[model samples]
Target: MKKLILTVLLSLSGVVAATAQPMCCYNPVLNCIATRTSVRQYAPTAIPDSVTTTLLQAAMCAPSAVNKQPWEFITVTNPEVRNAIKQAIPNSHAAKAPLCIVVCGDMNQALEGQARDFWVQDCSAATQNILLAAHSMGLGGVWCGVYPNTDRCEALCKVLKIPANVIPLNVVCLGYPDPNAPAPTPKDKFKPAKIHVNAW
Candidate 1:
């Protein structure tokens, strides 16, 4: 009887250790997600085409509604074009970054009729993947909103000469962060009060 009790305790301890191991380990994915912060100021250094391609690949890997994959990405490196975009959307500081990715949702690629509304959610997930991938690659980025605001959306379309079927969702400014920039504080947003057991 004592031998069986000892065996059970050993197994329980093993389970506890297994559960605690992840909290103490160096998890790169979790680190990337935790350290990702919106960096507005950037260095003059330009991001290479290879890195940009990798980021876009990461974006495209995001899940879509019914696999429609209605997202489109446009990388802008031209100062003139960036300046024009900044002028159109005055709140955006995208001109400062060496690279600006305009994330769009192609309405023509969406499902027919009312079901097409899922494109916005699909594009949002893609945008988040781009930001996370940029952070993982040691680059900083900022997401500047564009869609849901008719005026801002129209301004971007006019300046970039975007096709009517494609709508700009947001601009993700990407670059090497300025060395003098301050570090971001960790945001512990987990709230026990917000959680419900089984049902709300």
Candidate 2:
């Protein structure tokens, strides 16, 4: 009877320990999600290659329509090239960040109308992944839109020499934070009438 009681207590303690440790550091993930903000200012310090690769890996993990994975990333670390990109993008503060990742969607793999206009959705998901991963890594980043604007797209196309079918979706700037940014408070974006109980 004593041996069985001890075994039961040890098993219970093991279960408790497993649950207490959390599946994957939820607090840090929550901290990343809660404290993440669009960091416009960045320190000139360079980020190590390992960190950059980790962030890209996280971005690539984002889901895509039909598993088409119609996404491409162009990382620009050269100051001269980054400066040129900044000039091409009017009012884009991406140059401040030490690194910039250009997110694009492959038109050839798009389902209909480039995934029936679903390319943006897929690209946006990737961008969000970049942002979240940057935050989680204790780095700051921001997503700056570029594709929809013809002038901006044309300028980038001329500079990068990208093919016509590849669409530039956004430019993600990443670096060590230079400011104490605030998190966005959740707003009531949905109205009560918009809610449907069981039927529309």
Candidate 3:
């Protein structure tokens, strides 16, 4: 009985205690994670410098492999440059956003040997952190891929003059949500069937 009570107390404190039943809590961080969604349409209003700084700080807080911290960022506000990048990837939301943060993986800072590609994972985690930070601040963002598509990465590097040691992983398009744009409901992504306990 004491153990069950302790479990209930932990759940209320936003800690995930082992249980098959649905747990309840009011953690703001968890709420931010759960509610965050891609905002493809953005208003023309510019994001303030202070806000941009905060977003970047949040990105840098992401976990990295062996503390490699291999991420680098390029901020774009110029319309001509934005348009040039748009021509490279037609589906990118950056052209419409007031701020486009190009997240890159710095190979120079990456792990060696079989873990060489861990920079990609590190930068991806950073990108997600940026998006969540934006959402928590009432702004919105979308992730647009760049690497693996060699042609797109090359075009982006040419426009931005990216270093040879850095590879553009993705561009995070950010701005205030367009008031006229329809609000999207957060998707129900939790699937009990997908959860494999103990082993596969």
**Local distance difference test, candidate 2:** 0.82
lDDT (10s digit) by residue, model 1, range 35-148? 688888888999999999999999999999999999999999999999988987787877888999999999999988888889999999999999999998889899999998
Give the clash total for candidate 3.
0
Q: Candidate 3's residue-wise lDDT over 82-186, tens digit each? A: 888898778898788999999999999999999999999999999999999999999989999999999999989998999899999999999999999998778
- Clash pairs, model 1 backbone: none
lDDT of each: 0.90, 0.82, 0.90
Worst 10 residues of 1 by lDDT: 19-28
Estimate candidate 3's alpha-carbon lDDT, on a 0 to 1 scale. 0.90
What local lDDT does model 3 show for residue 173?
A: 92
**Model 3, 167: alpha-carbon shift in Å?**
0.3
Off by over 4 Å in 2: 1-27, 179-200
Q: Candidate 3: TM-score?
A: 0.87
> How far off is residue 58 in model 3, in Å?
0.5
Q: Which ten residues in a row have the lowest lDDT in candidate 3?
A: 16-25
Could you give candidate 2's per-residue lDDT for residues 61-163 as a string of tens digits?
A: 9888988888988988898888889999966676788999999988987888534568789889989989999887778787888979998888987777779
- Whose TM-score is higher: candidate 1's or candidate 2's? 1
